[model samples]
Target: MVNLTRIYTRTGDAGSTRLSDMSVARKTDLRVEAYGHVDEANAVLGMAITSGGLREDVVAVLRAVSNELFDVGADLSNPLVAEPKWEPLRIPPESIDRLEAWCDEFSESLPDLVSFILPGGTPGAAYLHLARTVVRRAERAGWAAAEAYGLEVSAGDEPGGVNPLALTYLNRLSDLLFILGRVANEGVGDVLWVPGKDREPVGERARRQREKIEKAQDDLGRSS
Candidate 1:
């Protein structure tokens, strides 16, 4: 089990951090960037979970995913060589398979998409869309890190490479989030985008922008 008795290590005061293996690296390393994006997606998902109006099923899946994302972070933090410690967590094929299964199960109930989906639906769906985009960015970061390292050639043969399934899991997670957006909308489905709807007069655009600005100010006022 992990212990956090000392919260202020101050080890990172020099803009460098230590990994699980006690090796030091810069804060801006690719591995750090990859895990940082995963943490961002996890935070967004957590916000989605705490908010009301989410379907019970959506909450259940996200709850499980929230846990697995930690595994993703752990896998990224610990680099693998020819042999890894028995206790270190590694994202396996089964984890990715579970995500694929969930996507398959949820997708069956959703209607086929005829138009592009805007990030507007229920409160849960909007947060899910935000999470999906963030996960895509995480996937890209993982790919860049993999390039800096190398892709898996054989089991534990690729030195210092991340678990390949971690990348696959993030890819499937974004797909599942898109499907969940449709599920959150229920019978209403996603808000379809009409291509030419925004080609109105400049005055109309200004009016919408003004409303957006007012809404932002009103939100700040409420918090204050």
Candidate 2:
């Protein structure tokens, strides 16, 4: 078990921080950027969990994601450092498979994708969608860092290049969020697909206007 000490060390006072290998780097290092993104993604997911009414199974999956993200962050913090004392922090291929499985499970419940749906749903679902997008950004940052370090081959070997599992997980996560949004809006009422009045073509505007009017009428009836 790691020791937990709250003693303040002013080591980072010069705008530099230490990595897992005890090497110091500027706070703006690429490794820092990558791991910071992971931390951001995890925090956003935590917010979604708090605000979204996720099913028990979904919550379980997200909990697993949180754990994986921590591992990813650790890997980013210490690249190519073979410290036998520190257990390997590789993201296994099975992790990607697990994300794929979850995506398949969630997608099964959603309607066939006939058209692109807008990204507004329940607040929790919307936040999940946002988190998914951020995760993609994080993956891209990781890939860039791998290329910069010329560790592409070794990194790619690890689940999704820098972290193949994370990439796969992010891709599936976006799909899951889209479906979750649909599920959240189901039977709560029809989702109004608002089109841009000024920018949209005439037919599109007319269709969206009709949808808006219908939704307004439904809302009035509910209030009455």
Candidate 3:
């Protein structure tokens, strides 16, 4: 239970703040950096939720993730707890599993990719792509924070050590965002990149590609 009776506390008037463990740390601490990125990613998701052409289901998932980001920040802020019956909230396997499941579910309806894509589709998809990249930055920050504290990098789900599921959830969250971008675009119509097209003019590449397409069609017709 959180009770915020007073809004402004000048405790952090200086350049330092306290962690959930009541330990003093500078604003530039790695734990702060980690949670900062998580907050940033969540902000991006918030902006993305306002983009047009987003489905209700996709928005629902984003809203849920936005809430979980707070949990992630809290988990990072509290390094350790001495209380016997109380522990800081940590990311769980179920969260990571849900991300993976949603990613798989959305990807199943999408067409296979022949080439990498440019991060521009519908407005909603574009925002989701942006959020996906930010989430990746958050994941890297989490990893760095864990390593800096000498926490168990493999797996630790307690207050003192960085939980592997925290990193795993962020990783899977980006994956889910990437696929949800396509889902926002009706599960197709991704802006595909033309490999090696920058080496030559668009006119030249387009002519060649057109011929290749025609030739492929001809081959298919003959086989039929």
Candidate 4:
């Protein structure tokens, strides 16, 4: 329902921009930083969607998430107020539930994790990994904003705080992206972690480390 006739607005040339409510704030404002990270996360997801070789269902999920992230940005950009002239686009709790459901569904088929995963697999999955990290960063920024501006609305027309639901959405979204990244590696499998594998220790040190790792893995297998 909104239209932008011009992309270039001289208003921000002073290093300040207007929020969704048309209130001016500095470019370095915590709220602005939070929503800016959300925008970055969305763009990375776009890369994942178009990277090719992704499962159709996963693609559909990412597409939906991309749209939701925009709303998340809107929710962050428009600070919470006691009463607004118009209803703001806020992230809903149901959206977080949907992300949880997606995480569970996608995780169902992935192999049980015996070790940590590295962020590399198929090209599509690599992009998903990248997106996941970006989402995590966005979530952190949201928390920082929440810390700076409390999560509760205050009296009057002044913006009070950020939306807690929007923060939760970002948290859940990062998890979903991780699960989908694993799903994207359906054929290639996950790039698993090996503790100190890169160090390549030799002789007695290497022997001790290998023995301990083997014993731990054996214990894990028996317990599972």
lDDT score of residue 22 within candidate 1: 62
Tell me the lDDT of candidate 4.
0.83
Model 1 spans > 4 angstroms off: 152-159, 197-224
Q: Please provide, for model 1 over 1-224, each residue's C-alpha lDDT reduced to its tens digit, 9 standing for 90 to 100.
A: 78889989888999999766566878998888998999999999998888767889889999999999999988887776655555567788998898889999988866555457789657888899999999999999988988887765335544487767888989999999998877777734566664453334257775675555445434433432
Clashing pairs in 4: none
Against the true structure, candidate 2 reaches a TM-score of 0.75
**What TM-score does candidate 4 get on C-alpha atoms?**
0.89
Error of 1 at 71 (Å): 0.1
Candidate 3: pairs in clash: none
Compared with the true structure, all predictions reach lDDT values of 0.79, 0.65, 0.77, 0.83
TM-score versus the correct structure, for each prediction: 0.82, 0.75, 0.82, 0.89
Candidate 4 Cα misplacement greater than 4 A, ranges: 197-224
Q: Per-residue alpha-carbon lDDT of model 3 for 1-224, expressed as tens digits?
A: 78999988998889899877677889988888888999999988988898666888888999999999999888888775345235678888888888888988888867665556568757888888998998899889878878777464323444355666778888899889988876776633666565565424469767677566445434433432
The deviation in Å at residue 220 for candidate 4 is: 17
Q: How many clashes (backbone N, Cα, C below 3 Å) per candidate?
A: 0, 5, 0, 0
Q: What is the lDDT of candidate 1?
A: 0.79
lDDT of 4 by residue, 115-199 (tens): 6778886888889889889889988999999999889997865558888999999888888888888788777666666677523
**Cα RMSD, each candidate:** 7.8, 5.4, 5.6, 4.1
| Candidate 3 error regions (>4 Å) | 80-85, 153-159, 196-224
Residue by residue across 115-191, what tens digits does model 2's lDDT show? 34555546666777677778877777776776666454343324212434544555565566556555554434324
Report residue 55 deviation for candidate 4 (angstroms): 0.5
